[model samples]
Target chain A: MKARVHISLKTGVHDPQGKAIRNALSGLGFAGLGEVRQGKLIELELDETDPDTAREAVDRMCRGLLANPVIETYHIDLEA
Target chain B: MKARVHISLKTGVHDPQGKAIRNALSGLGFAGLGEVRQGKLIELELDETDPDTAREAVDRMCRGLLANPVIETYHIDLEA
Candidate 1:
């Protein structure tokens, strides 16, 4: 099974990297762009066959190291 | 409008970060894991209302700065 984790900053948290990207876009002539937020995507290939177990393990991975719960939120997608 | 860009490394490219994460997961006791790949998710808010325009602009952003085309591939998702 495979699990994909999408991690993004909480709504109220400031994202300096996003701001830099937004500015870069404008400088590159993409002036129509507005605000930008940056996040992470982690794709994991697991030996486990059960979707439930894989998701649970990946969820633990997210809470433990992949994300900072205070400022970021993560969602997991399991694939066979 | 909003556009989400998913940037991932091309197959066969070495990813030290992914390896490190995988090692860390094992250290944390998630030993059932196999391979892990990490990527970036960039969310953009655009001023354009037309989906076509927004996607085109975001696509340009991806080609220009959001992704390195040589070793990475990116997909854009446009949202109203």
Candidate 2:
């Protein structure tokens, strides 16, 4: 099985890294870019598992390890 | 319009950050986790634009700013 999870800062949270990257993009000549926000992509390979069960496991993993819930939220896609 | 771009280190490239996160996951008791790779997700809100031209522009953005071609590759999803 494979999974891809994206974790991002919640709306209204300041993102200094994203701002820095956006500034760099415009400085490098990308026009009409309205706003930029950055997140993390986490790809994982897992042992054979039921999709629903695996998703539950992953949700727990995110809550316990992959994210700092106070500042971020996560979404995931799982494939077998 | 909106776009989400994910850029990752290619296979065989060393990723210390990924390793660190994987170790942390295991420490936090995520079991049966085989492997992990970390990447960046960049979200952009753009002015109304043709999808094809926007994709082209974004490809340039990745090549020039979002990724270091020496070690990364990127994919994008565009939505209006």
Candidate 3:
């Protein structure tokens, strides 16, 4: 099984890195760009066969070690 | 229009960040976890209305600024 976690900052959190990318894009002459946000994508291969179990464990990982809940939000996707 | 860029390292590239996450997960008692890889996701709000134009512009942005072609690969998704 495979799982993916997408971790991103909450709406109100400051994202300087994202802002930098937006600025860089404009500087490169790619026009008509609006708000740009950046996040993390984590791909995992799991030994667990059940999708539900894999998702549950990955969710726990997100809460404990993967994401900082105060300012970040995360969602898990499990693939069988 | 909205576009998302998923940027990830190529197979041969080493990802220490991912390894660290795997170690942390195991330390936190996450069992049956295998290889973990970390990547970047950039979300963009584009001013262009046409999907093709938006995709092309984002593709250029990926090649020029968002991703390092030597070690990373990127795919773009467009949403209306």
Candidate 4:
């Protein structure tokens, strides 16, 4: 099975990297762009065949190590 | 309008960051995980009201600055 996890900083958390990207975009003449928030996408190929089990394992992975629960939130997408 | 750009390394490109993350996951006891790939997700809030215009601008942003055409490919998603 394959799964993708999108991890993003929760709203209200300061994102310096995103701010830097926004500034860079403005400098490059993209003035119309508004707030930019950057996040991480982790694509995982799992050995497990069961979709339910795979989803649960990836969810655990996100909570255990992939994301910082306090400031980051993650969404999991299972491949059909 | 809102747009999202997902930038990922093309197959055959070396991904040191992804390797490091994979190693870290294994160290932390996530052994069932297979080949792991890491990518970037950039979320943008645009001043443009039209979805089509916002998508085009974001696509240009990806090609011109956000993603490397050689190793990275980007997909743009426009919110309704």
Q: What do the candidate models score in CA lDDT, each in turn? A: 0.90, 0.89, 0.91, 0.89
Error of 1 at A10 (Å): 0.6
Separately for all candidates shown, the number of backbone clashes (residues 3 or more apart, or on different chains) is: 0, 0, 0, 0
lDDT of 3 by residue, A1-80 (tens): 99988898899899999999999888888888888999999999999998888888888888888889999999888888
TM-score of each: 0.96, 0.96, 0.97, 0.95
Tens-place lDDT per residue, model 2, A1-80, is 99899999999899999999889998997889888999999988888489998898888888988888999999989989
For candidate 2, give the lDDT of residue B53: 87
For candidate 2, state the interface root-mean-square deviation in angstroms to 1 decimal.
1.1
Q: Sort by TM-score, best first.
A: 3, 1, 2, 4
Best by the TM-score measure: 3
RMSD of each: 1.0, 1.1, 0.9, 1.2
Q: Deviation in angstroms for A19 in model 4?
A: 1.0
Give the native contact fraction of candidate 4: 0.86
Q: What is each candidate's DockQ, to 2 decimals?
A: 0.89, 0.84, 0.91, 0.83
Cα deviation of B8, candidate 1, in Å: 0.5
Interface RMSD values for all candidates: 0.8, 1.1, 0.6, 1.0
Candidate ranking (DockQ, best to worst): 3, 1, 2, 4
Encode model 4's per-residue lDDT on A1-80: one tens digit a residue: 88988999999999998999899899989878788999999988889888998888898888888899999999999996
lDDT of 1 by residue, A1-80 (tens): 88989999999799999999888888887886677999999999999999888888888899999999999999998889
Once fitted onto the true fold, the runs of candidate 1 whose alpha carbons sit more than 4 angstroms away are none
